[model samples]
Target: MKKLMLFTVIVAISIATKAQQYYDVTKYGAKKDSSTLATKSIAAAIAAASKAGGGTVYFPAGKYLTGPIHLKSNITILIDAGAELHFSDNFDHYLPMVESRYEGVDVFSFSPLFYAYKAENIAIKGRGLINGHGKKWWDYALTFYKNQTARNKYQLLFDSANKNIVLPDDATQMQRGFLRPPFIQPLYCKNVLIEGITITNSPFWTVNPEFCENVTVTGVTINNPKSPNTDGINPSSCRYVHISDCHISVGDDCITIKSGKDVPGRTKAFPAENITITNCTMLSGHGGVVIGSEMSGDVKKVTISNCVFDGTDRGIRIKTTRGRGGVVEDIRVDNIVMKNIRDQAIVLDMEYSKTKPEPVSERTPKFRNIRFSNITAYTKKAMYINGLDEMPVSEISLHDVVFEAETGIVIRNVQDIELRHVRVNTKTGPAVSAEKSSRILIDALSTVKPLMDAPLIRLTDVKEALLTNHWLFDGSHKFADIKGAATSNILLHNNILKGATVTTAADVPTGTVQL
Candidate 1:
């Protein structure tokens, strides 16, 4: 006990002594004005802190213009309140290409505004701002797309990227793709913390932590509009990520979880797992919380709760396609509220970019064992689940869901689904429609003021389904419409229907079976 007490006291003393070490950027000849470039001075301060066995590099309240800031292990960048690190717009300033990932593909490109590789215990905290002067990057991209020479140059880069060939000497190909660098990216990092920071006008993804672990992002606000490809928080190929109490409004998805894309991603095979998101408000993005268009490394064990999505394109979206050999499973989401959603409130699409059916192989994407409960959404469509014909999405459940939308749920090529205590108020289409599915259980479902001709429940090519304890109010359509040659064994019992009929195909022969 005496030896343990002595060790604790020594460690405490070391921490207290280290807390006194602060390297100020101004002391390193950083100009406070936004006009003068302070990249070298800031780098000097960071290096000083790192050289002194790790400390805080402080930036006082001022607009400090800088280029890329390389981060080191055991160092923290403290941008004080009212302080802003404005990134330079000159692409030449971000020269000397670094090894990084762009859009799920590894490349040698201009460094991210705050770049860190293989770092540990690094943090960017304090109520400050990191502004990426995105207008110049966005404008250059517009020009790059319009010119044929630029297109050819970018094509060379793309070819090199796919072929896994690095062309460090080809200056034209290096400068070609106007693929702007990310705002803050820490690749292969550990014990990372980014808190209480306001980021704006990002050239690319705002807070992207790739191939990282033990990352905590809390109390952050990202406001990036009219900036293309500016996703707020993307934890790609990462593990043990916690994101909470954030308010995000961006041009793309608010928070997207990914692993990698296509061949290179599958070759790496790094799965992103153990992610938790809570108490976040999302506004004006493609999707509030999305998973993949580039998930080839599989994503699992994700939980999202106590979130609000306002004015987003979709509430919760999981999308993947063929040539991405990944399995997304074991996701649980509850206590979500959404309003003014332009697209489906909840969606699981396995055919995001794949148009035609391909043979099931290692490249086939799989989605299974996902649950959503206590969700209330007002959107254009309640839910959409489109799975591949060869490999159907399986084992999904929704409990206590209330959706108000123009169209109802549309499901295809799914199996083993259960919906309990669900209510949908749709202006058009059936309340629930299923095709090429089986083993569905719909219990305690209700619809508000259904259409005159539309059926409350429509089933096509479905089998082994049970619908019980549902209520249909006045001016409602048919209670059930069962069709298709493959439909069989549907049970509709204990339903309170007013002015409704049960229609079926000629082969069904009393499709509403009571057991």
Candidate 2:
């Protein structure tokens, strides 16, 4: 008993001593003035803390301008409430390039503003700010898009790198180096935490953790408006990630989950799994929460709950292309509210990049076992799921969804879909439409104000569909419009039609619909 008590007391004292050890950047010659570059001073502080066997690198209440700050394991960056870490806009400071990934491809690019390679138990916490000062990077990137020669040059560099050609070490951003680094990227890290910070003006995707495990990002606020590719909180090829209580207003996706891309990604074969995102509010972004265009390494077991998205281009989006060979499955989204969505409230598209029709193989992406419940949205378009004709998306389920939009739900090239308690208030088009799909079950599906000229439900080339317990309003003109010779065995049971007519195209065979 005495020995145990002694050990406990020693551990407590050790922890207390470690907590008291703070490596202040000012002591290392970092100036409080924001104009003077304090990159080396900050790096010195971090190095001293690391040499002291892991301590807090403390920033007092002042603005400090610096270049990229490399982090070490067992390090804590604690910024005080009024302190701001303003990163330099000078591209040269990023220097001679580092080992990094660009848009899911492996490349030696500029170092991220806050980066750690192969680190463990690293944290950046406190109520402060991190300013990326990315206007210059954004402007430089825009020039390549405007000038075709610059764009071609960048493409050639990227293509050659993919073919295992090494880029020049001194390549500038205007030359062979065109990729912008993310704001905070911990590559091959473990046990990472980022909390209670306001990050703004990111050069690219902010808070991107690549090849990480056990990451937690909470109480973080990110605001980067009109900044190109400044996605907030993207976890790429990571596992066991938890993100909550974040307010994000960014130029790209507010939160994105990815698992590498293309051949390199497939070769790595690291699946991003067991991710949870909750209590997040998004504004003015491309998508509220997105999964892949880079998910060639497969993504699974993700849940997003209790989130609100306002003024975003889309709400929930999972997109991939034919060349991206992966399976995205076991995704669940619940209790989501979205307003002013400029595009579809929800989209699952397998054709994000158009390519020629190819046979079903490892190159064909697959989406299955995705479920959404208790969602409310006010958007231009409600829902759209467009899978490949060869490899259709399958096993989708939605419950208690209400959408007010200009256009309604459209499903194509899908199978085994179930929608319950789904309501759509649309200005035009059918409330629900499915084509090249099968085994669809829609229960309690209704519309508050249906289009008078259009049918409530439309099916083309669908097989084995069951529409049950639907309540049609008084203004409904047609109940259903069934078409195509391949469509068969459509059963409508216990529906309140409200004097709506059911129409079938001439190509539809007899006994295709049973009332």
Candidate 3:
């Protein structure tokens, strides 16, 4: 009993010491006036906290106009409830280029507004706001895009990047002035936590964590207007990432997972693995939860569930192309609700850039073993999966899913797909359509309401398929539509449509059965 009492006393003392180790920015001569530049004062406070063996730098209730704030190891920035860190518009504040990623390729570019590299045990928490004064940056990018010489120079930089060629230097590259930095970026860090912050008006992606481990981004609100390239939370080349309870409404994808690009990405050989996203709300983004146009180092073992996407362009999107040369496999998405989706509710396209297939090499991208279950969506289009001819997507599965849209599910160049207990309700198109695909099993399929011209299921150029146990509710059209010469060995039996019938073109073989 005496030893237990002593241990309690020691623990209480430790907690008390930690509570006292907060350095306020006001003590370092940081005023509340939004006009005055408090960059140096905030930096001094951070340095003081670091010099005292790692402590919290607290920002009291004020509007602090600052520039780039470099984060160090074992330090935390606690912005009080009413404090606001309004970043400066001057690009010179982010000069002396740092090593970071532009899009998916590595480059020496302007540092992110809140930048940390190779740090450990860092956090930026509190219910404050970080506003990236980004109007000037956006206007400058538009001007550069309009200028012919600048646009050509920027295109050359991208072409060089694809060929694994580095440009001369940051100064010469800045002549074009196209690279926009992210709002908060922590590269190659460990034990990073960002919580309870409202981030807005970013020049680029809002919070991007690259090459980091054990990252937790929770209870954060990201509201960037429908500008270009303002993703909410992008985790690239990261491991053990947990994103939960985040409300993201951005211009681009709300949450995208990536791991570098083509040859450079393969060279790094760091796959983004072991990621989990749950209980998040997404609104007004390009995609609710996306994976790649930049997954060249491969992304695997990702799980996204229990998320609501409202008014996004696409619900769940996975896109890559030739020259990416990576394998995306073992992904699972379940229990998702989406509404007002402008595009396909779910999409997996391996022809993102439409780069024609070359000889089978390291540049060929592959997607396999993806599963989606328990999804409900009301959108413009149901789902679209387009795989390449050279390497078809394989082993895709869907169970207990429901989609109501203007169009239906379309599959091309896919193999080994199984849809069990799925319900697709489209107003003007077929419930399921497959072309140039094989080994598909559709069971317990139904529709919301019947259609006159559209069938419940359509198969073209598909082989070795089974369509059975359908519940066509209204039976407005035919039960099944089979066409094309290459389609054979299809069995349609024991469906529960009262007045529906099967229609087959002349080229459909006799081996395709209807009973």
Candidate 4:
């Protein structure tokens, strides 16, 4: 009986080994030359691999030009070293639009360059290059942006389609499409992995995985020219995402997290949560790691660490407007280094779009419980935090942060902020200027080369602020300037102010500042 059991186990192992197949594209009528269209041959190989209970569709050591490549479940696209898969620039090749979300709106648009819908255990791996030749697409997009006639045409077509008013058969996909498809999108996929691939010249958001779970993207290098909307990696409404060891240089934000936009996003209500990004380097992007201008379905529990940003517009940004009604909370960023940032190193603004003040409802976005630690930056501006009057940004904490900037920190309409061990070397303006805030704590806050005419800290309409342990440097002015009638409960204790006065405005009540 033991001998029979051993023989059965051996037979099972042999069968499983044999079933793990490798379907090479070259063997399936795919030419090695870059001129020939190899879409059909690649699809044939994928189909065969899927039919045989899944396998690795291999591209070995050559350049092959293709159109969109659709992936199925249990498939691994292993592009070997020296293999380059160059996607065609022709827009017509991405025909028969697939279900995709473009910039937070659900649209049946052009298929992404490599798309998978509702697939499981899918991966695109191996050390190779996948290039999206997107110059033509970018030119068309530029024309579409500049010409109002083209915009009106597409808008009418989109509105008509949404209203179920169909007429002309000659209406091309371009007329029906409103936004360009991303370079890589796996919609509603599970256990997805994209590793060891170098992608460049992407048409739109590169490495976008929408509504995916347990996604891991590592060792990927994305280099796109300064084109429109070429974001590096955007995991929209995904959960359990792990992104590390990525080098990104793109036209837009290096890494952006989103759930959805306005009403449609709120209706779906799938928050992007439990994401971790580490050991990434960003260069020449709009922002290093951005949260949203499109978060209506709340984003929470994101942690970013050990990242480096060079020549970006902003280092860490969480931005939303009034209509983008979302809650961004429980975010932690640590161990970051930034240089040559054009804008503020850190910003959390709720007024990204221009709108009048509305009632505090779902239309008012909220940002709370975000923390930053162990950060160093050299930038134009240090930090800016502006919250809505109706719903102020709250519970923000920063520790051990140093900034060398042209200007200083600005805070407006915030509450429950804690700044500990913070240093700002500013060329102009007060080291920290706060207004319309309450419940603030400043500990060990200092400046290098204090401005001669400006106070080290300025407060207006602020209440319940406790300024303690600040090592004030000597220049030419006051230590604290207090203003506004509503200012109350201001305490200054354990500070080396060096005989600088704490001045208050005339409207500020007597005994507002307690030393």
Candidate 5:
């Protein structure tokens, strides 16, 4: 007991000593309780702390309502335990709009609530609660979008009343986002860290680090389940990011990594790369850890591991549209545990288009060079990989993957696919279905409880395909669904099946026969 106490004391002392340079807001003439102009005073204290060298600006336990508190370089905004920082809903507080990424486009939108722009080595840490109080804007949007006739008339789908959301460049449209904005956004900054903060119920996205580099968001909890467009952490166009040990359950993706979108993104040509996400748990949302619908430049070199998705939409998803004009490649997702997935456990959709009507320019999803291995999924549906007929998914690999899904696995318009050590056990479904590829290979597959779920390993319009060591058990039907007649150079060898049927051309042999 004495040694344990000593360790705890040492750790506490180390934390305190490391925070030696503290700027207590009360000492800088900031009100502790809700009073006159505590907002400006607290912001001034944070700014002043930066001007006189950088240190930790402490927000004591109370309600500190502010418009927008801008942190300077090398400053840490540490909210003490029991601290609740409430932002004023009055839109006038945040003025002079700044450059920010909204929805998927770069715009000078409403000022982010807790903002840090072009600054270095900043942080928002401490075990306190930071709330945005954004219920008003969300409810307003949900109600406003209920009018169907107005939407059809105005070429709008949802939220027709609000024709557009803006930074109020003209000052008349009203700052809806400004009311309760993105809680914390560090734009074009570097060496950032947002750790040990419980940020909840933001009006907009929780933490968006745009065009920044060297970001480390560790041990943070973001819980906002009702707000629209409240993505937990969107590192748009940033590089060298590490997000780990976080609990994110929002209305949107837990953490969406983006480069850019469409013409502006491709012209700018800046890709988000070198991202690592691990040890994270996500509740209900669009996707657990997602990559682009907005990556136009290029999204590459991403690795996600040691994650859990509970009742979420998907475990790992990569979505993009046709005209988005982004190339997502070189991705690896492994060691993931999932349960109660509504859709496919691992889904690659390049044709995720919104029903909202707009001038059709180029809105298609292009996906290639992806890999998922070492994942165990107990899903409600099977896995899905839907590629474009004109533009196929390239260089894909799935290894050591096991599934117990209700639906079957589907792959289309792919090339250079390698499946090894894969097992599927569905109640009643087909095992494998693939199409439109070249250089395809499947080896070492095992199935269980076969009848409703038959094993169908087939190729369609595929080129140079190969299958070997495919075994089926439990009275299964092999050669389940191979129907693409245009495929060429088919090779099959060393496969075992019971009660499974095989259907192929009479001229082709059972082993080592090239088309």
Candidate 6:
């Protein structure tokens, strides 16, 4: 009897393995023409494939207009090289709101174009197009936000407390007057793979994966510009993810790694960790690679390698503020190349004050353990490091960084920072600016052009700072270290000044050791 039971188990396993089935959406009565209701046909295809165990649902070379494609476990949606899966324009097609996560909150709301919840071993691989019809949605959101006057912005989320009540969800759905966030949102899935697809024109965020695990996204191209909040690839509150060989050009962040927001994110304690993004190109975005403002959970062990950014507003941005207390640590960015960056190349602000910046505390963000190496950037505004006076940045480092900029670098509110072999070629600006730091080490700083500010180096309101081996050829004391009042314990040793100076700030307290 036991042997028979074992045999039955084996048979069940075999049947589970046989779930691998295939469905051709175009062949299964889906409309090939652009103006057809392919929703039913496509859903039928997915349903059939899902029922038959799990297998690859294939699409041939044509434009198959579809709505949300809910994925299942062990299923793969493979599209042909010439095929295009254009998502539906009408939002109501994604009705019957399902459980999903947006900005870290788990709710029942709009479905994504390609969505998988609690599914495992699912993969979407093909050389095809996933066009997120996002123009109208984005226009609405941007216009509404811009025109929304004096209306209590915080009241939007406050009014959402009515959701917990057992009301008719369909009747109380959030009105679409532009409060929507993204078009493609995949939440709470596992072991997913998306490769070799071109996703474009997202009305909101193009691809969002929240509260998932072991996901791999590679060789994808995302292009969305005519919209606001059109973040290209945002993987929030997920674990063990790898993103590589992706090209992104969007209006917002190109590749943003985030956690959840505020109370829910903190209470859940689901931090986004063990993520790696490599070999990517970002062109024209508000931030090339960002981790931020809503990251109330811990964001750690993130590595961005061999990435290139061009015409981006900001390159490496880690922004957060008070009332969103989180820990951002162990972030390493290496081999980054940037060209014509408009804003700060590397910006870290604990006070990410859009409206009014607040303090840095447990209800605020704490940034530390950030390291960057082998970076070459041409920037307009140079580098920036901003933190609160209370809780500044810590354990920061930059090695082998060469930046040729029209502006320069600004450092503030930091501790235990180090720069090794950092070279700058600037038209006009300070090469390095340090303020309110403890234990700073600058080594091998070489600059080519002089600035009107006479800033081979600049320092103010700092303590426990070290300036060594400052190699300059202009033969001027251009490096100014203005230790302000209450600034003490500065050591300048073996420093070669081309065009730099040192001054004791009139506000400098007595008994300051300036060498």
Error of 2 at 460 (Å): 1.0
Q: Tell me model 5's lDDT, rounded to 2 decimals.
A: 0.75
Comparing 4 and 5 by TM-score, which wins? 4
Shift in Å, residue 318, candidate 5? 0.5
TM-score of 4: 0.94
When superposed on Cα atoms, how far off is each prediction in RMSD? 3.9, 3.7, 3.8, 3.6, 7.3, 5.3
lDDT of 4 by residue, 1-515 (tens): 99999999999998887577789999998888887999999999999999988889999999999999999999999999999999998877887667888777667677899999999999999999999998788888778655654545445545554553222212353254566779999999999999999999998999999999999999999999999999999999999999999999999999999998887678778989999999999998999999998788889999999999999999999999987788999999999999999999999999997788889987679999999999999999999999998889999999999999999899999999999999988898888899999999989888868777888889999999999997776663678899999999999999888878788899998998899
Which candidate number maximizes TM-score?
Answer: 4
lDDT: worst 10-residue window of model 2: 165-174
TM-score of 1: 0.93
lDDT of each: 0.89, 0.90, 0.88, 0.90, 0.75, 0.78
- The candidates, ranked best first by lDDT, are 2, 4, 1, 3, 6, 5
Off by over 4 Å in 5: 1-19, 35-37, 145-180, 354-366, 505-515
TM-score of each: 0.93, 0.93, 0.92, 0.94, 0.85, 0.89
TM-score-wise, the better of 1 and 6 is 1
Over the stretch 1-515, how does candidate 6's per-residue lDDT look in tens digits?
A: 99999999999998876654468887778876656867778777778887776678888888888877888787788988988888877867766556666555555666677778788888888999888778766665556556666544323433453256222112222333124546555577888898898888886777788888998999999998646788888988889999999999998899898887666667677888999999999998999999987688789999999999999899999998766778999999999999989988899987776435555445767899999999999888678888777778999999999888876788988988998889877777678888887778888787767665566776777787777877776744466646567577777788777436676667877766456
The runs of at least 3 residues in candidate 1 whose Cα sits more than 4 Å from the true structure, single-residue gaps closed, are: 1-15, 150-176, 507-515
Clashes of each: 0, 0, 0, 0, 21, 15
Worst 10-residue lDDT window for candidate 6 reads: 165-174
Models sorted by TM-score, best on top: 4, 2, 1, 3, 6, 5
In Å, residue 320's CA in model 5 sits off its true spot by 0.8
